[model samples]
Target: MSAVTFVSNPIHEGWTLTHTGGDAPSVVERATVPAQVPGSVPLDLDRAGLLADGPREDGTAADWMAWCEWRYATEFAATPATPGERVDVVFDGLDTVAAVRLNDIEIARTKNMHRSYRFDVRELVQGGANTLTVDFVSALAYARGIDADARHGDVSRAYRGVRKMAWGFGPFGGPPAHTAGIWGGVRIERWRVARLDEVRPLVTLDGDSGRVQVHVRVERASGEPLTVYATVAGAEASAQIPPGEVTGVVTVEAPHVEAWWPHGHGPARLYDLVVDLHSTDERLDTHVRRIGFRSAVLTGAVNVADAGVESPETPQVSPRTEQVSVTVNGRPLDLRVERWMPLDTVLARIAAEDVRARVEEQRDAGVGVLHVDGVGVYESPAFYETCDELGMFVVQDPPFVGDGYRAGAPVQGEAIEETREHVARLAPHPSLLTYGTVEDRAYGSLVSGIIAVLDHDRLTT
Candidate 1:
């Protein structure tokens, strides 16, 4: 595209955190200490020797921390934006409700910890060192403020209103530990021409041929002619985008494609799928991900199908019956399932090697499927990549458990966007067999509807 230029600077240092009594502005700082992005308030407190060693029987310290607001501040140097250029601060994840400010001016506000956010800062960023701050409100307080009718079978009222992990609120027999902070990486990106917003690759098989469709979306600076290119499994495809159009898809087909299989059944075959955005000869942005070719279906006791039974004396009647079985590549699979739990309550403390090791352990134990519970936060991308490599199937549940959450417009809207983002991230993995249905007292229908609309190819139970 029009002489594209893109540079990303990760802000990984010089972060300091402070706690305040509430969400309101506080001039008095309490216990300022060095902080880490992709970290949580509890983690920083422990590192600073401000928290107790182990879980307290009384939960006095934990309760106090959960009600206090925390703020993370940092400073970074950047050159001012030039003509036709854009600068934005991107957060991969933010724990719960928070407000982002640049140079003392509010730039953006975020509520969902599972969703990524980007705020254009070209106008606010300075040529020299500029202050960037994220102020997080008390997650427990915010959740408790939401007004919703509590129904029967509700697990935790504190977690029902907020889009957070339920396990931290003493659900699933876990200790109560309400976590908050920047739980993912933060970076400043400067670009011109256009940037890739999202890229999704979907694989399907037709007899001996495998088809891959890569859907791409871009944020453009102006109406310009662009092309989307995708290559996978030695096959390439390109699509010309109409001027001003922001979305396009490229399809590639490979004959006699090898299907990916679970461990002990067959070899797991994976291919690199690369998508590039181009304007004329220059490449604007590229997205790369590993994908495998395979089809998984859930049957028996889970998926109810209508069957017609004919009697000698009566006409045919349709009756729904449970078909409880799982199949890969049209063959029945004997599932050895294991529940995958988070290694730590502070998500950022879990490293990539830890995830790989845990999944490897499951694979060694002959676990074919990992039942990722819905009560916890979404695992990092490394978790799924490990499953894809080890040939382990994953049955992911939405972030809704046995709770009666408010189905207000705001709650429904957040849940919809969260499900969409998660499905897009997890759909390309051949190991992901099904997106489990949320069978809670509330939000079950909403979650199922979102999954059905976003990923109809995968089975839902």
Candidate 2:
């Protein structure tokens, strides 16, 4: 039997950008310039010598760019697909809002910059060259159209209605540049037989033993019986999944496992957990996750008066403050946290090495924890991976900041989904200790409920 095949083609070059001045999307015949994928409009415009040099005190350049619409176009040749093969256009991230088209046919519409998107383009892709266009609408215009009641009270109100980061919206930190573009990589994936949809590993330690429970989900073209194999720390486990079932679980236990520790305490030991999908003797897909065995808990004292549980008869009782503490591996850890903000105003300009360097600076300063502030965008995966290796703890806050804003159904739904994706992506990292949102009391119950349910292993404040 032949093994299933999977291939990825990255669309990185041959991109051209066009900028239009109006609020609506239209074609502009002037100043078309070469562009780069995984880049922003400001970066491209500056490269083409179209953008003004230096920051303006009046913020005219930033405001002008934020109000205009930008489009990026690229072309690539599609390869012929074999029988039972599936082709998809995968966007790792899109800044703010965008409409993606393949050969002039709209394939996907995205609004959130923090989430990834994928569109099935098997029918749209031809064997020859095809044109791909991503037309980005003005984020400022979109935010202005939202209802007044759905926004906060400050300048950040313009950014609250949309899922974009609030760092650039002034009054907050960073530049006043409201960025837009394909800030993440775009690629085409072709696969046969089956593909891994999600791979989540929950790591736990009991005394000297460590247990890893891997939950696997797959999408298959046929109703074939598949098996999932998980290997970690010299131990292996396999599960025979029945046909028509999309999910399976495998557990691997390691005896005499070393525990992972935070900085200043002990060595941060890490192990690779590899998972493979198999149909009989042939492998279909594989995934690898780096995990560490440790236990982190957040304990605190709650005040009855502050929690609104005080009665009139208890008027003599004073409102007590909550004293919070963190314990890791059955030892109390002193948290010396520093805010991890954006390294640059433009997201695409922040490289992996830059992230590593920033993290190293914090680690060298005797900082044990890096607090990912709520006002900033989600740090790239490289940030978490670096923290995991360097033995620094991370406490993350969701991107909501300032006075809590009321969100309509669409915005609220997207926020919930984005939270789910973020939790799933960051769960494997040992350095991730807890999640706390800014203005938690003002957010609606639905978002808080979703986070609590999805991240039951970690503390949510």
Candidate 3:
């Protein structure tokens, strides 16, 4: 793997944010930090003292949500494009939409904030000083042409899906919310041999032992020999890596392990697993994952027509159509809890301590389970970790709203991959009870199949 330069939080690099309202970026100014690459207009406006403090004269509060335009520009010293090495600019996340340019060349365009974007800047960037600019447009206007019907059954879901100003809403608006500007960070991933693309950790629990199936994916930048190394709970395993894109699995085991339990039952125990891409003895890239020893299942009965109950006059199977039960670690659990979601509109703004505080509050108040609408929404790693520590189970999913009403197979496929990613992120936590079913129960079976295809072990409702 090549050298990776993390330009996370561009604010620290003395970058300037210009509200480029016209055709080109006008010389503008704002504070920039290293971890602040995920800068947005609402956040910027609020910080700049431009956003309305309360309801406006027109009875609208968040006018800046659709009114502001942001141009984030930064200069960094970079190694010139090497003849053998490749340089790629990767933005882990952006807002609703953006146009990225390196030097003066247009390198990439962003549409959906949910997906990540990578642009090859091997030719555009040179050694020495470099100029990188991300022009973020108005998300409200850009979302106008968004095919809501093709994605979510309603445009509201599409609009609400994007990270905008939704939390702490009142009157016309309280805080301006728009999925604009760099929401994640701009990363310069430089590598010559290979780069670790993904690490999918599959963990399972048995009678007296806990196991982890580590699946590692690598992207071959050069046809150089490589091996993958994984270390979990002091146990280690290694495998040879092939060219192009390839996946390899390593098994790690711990005998006579104690199971994880929620709240009153017991403590949530977590183990760390570290994976590395290596060349002979040299470590290329490394990532650490957490795993837990516990399993959850949702078992119950579903009422069918019973062959004789189906008639033209009484077409419906009716209210007693299904009975769902919950169990944790093979033991039946009497579940009675209210679902929870943070009140904050801009979740990214919430600090880790704040998240932990909320989770603690919920657990202290006797919330047995946190029905996380979907794994995609309310996506805070701290949120999951806190639940794990507090022993509060989370019923997670892919996307919450407009589930069974999704438009096509592409959506379902996307959902499956996201579920895999989501499960992998939260796999180490013990507070997760079960993956929940889609809200739109009409095509519930199809959605369930999508989730099952990826997360095969966990129970789904």
Alpha-carbon RMSD, each predicted model: 5.5, 5.1, 6.6
RMSD of candidate 2 to the truth, in angstroms, is 5.1
**Model 1 RMSD, rounded to 1 decimal:** 5.5
Report the lDDT of model 2 for residue 392: 89
For residues 99-124, write the lDDT of model 3, one tens digit per residue.
88899788876654554567778888
TM-scores of the candidates are 0.89, 0.89, 0.78
Error of 2 at 117 (Å): 0.2
Best candidate, lDDT: 1
- Predicted structure 2, TM vs. truth: 0.89
Across 69-175, the per-residue lDDT of candidate 1 in tens digits comes to: 88999999999999988899999889888999999999988888868888999999888999999999977777767734322333355677777777777765656
Indicate whether candidate 1 or candidate 3 has the larger lDDT.
1
Off by over 4 Å in 3: 1-12, 22-36, 52-61, 147-176, 300-325, 374-378, 403-420, 439-450, 459-461
Q: For model 3, what is the error of residue 276's alpha carbon versus the real structure, in angstroms, after optimal superposition? A: 1.7
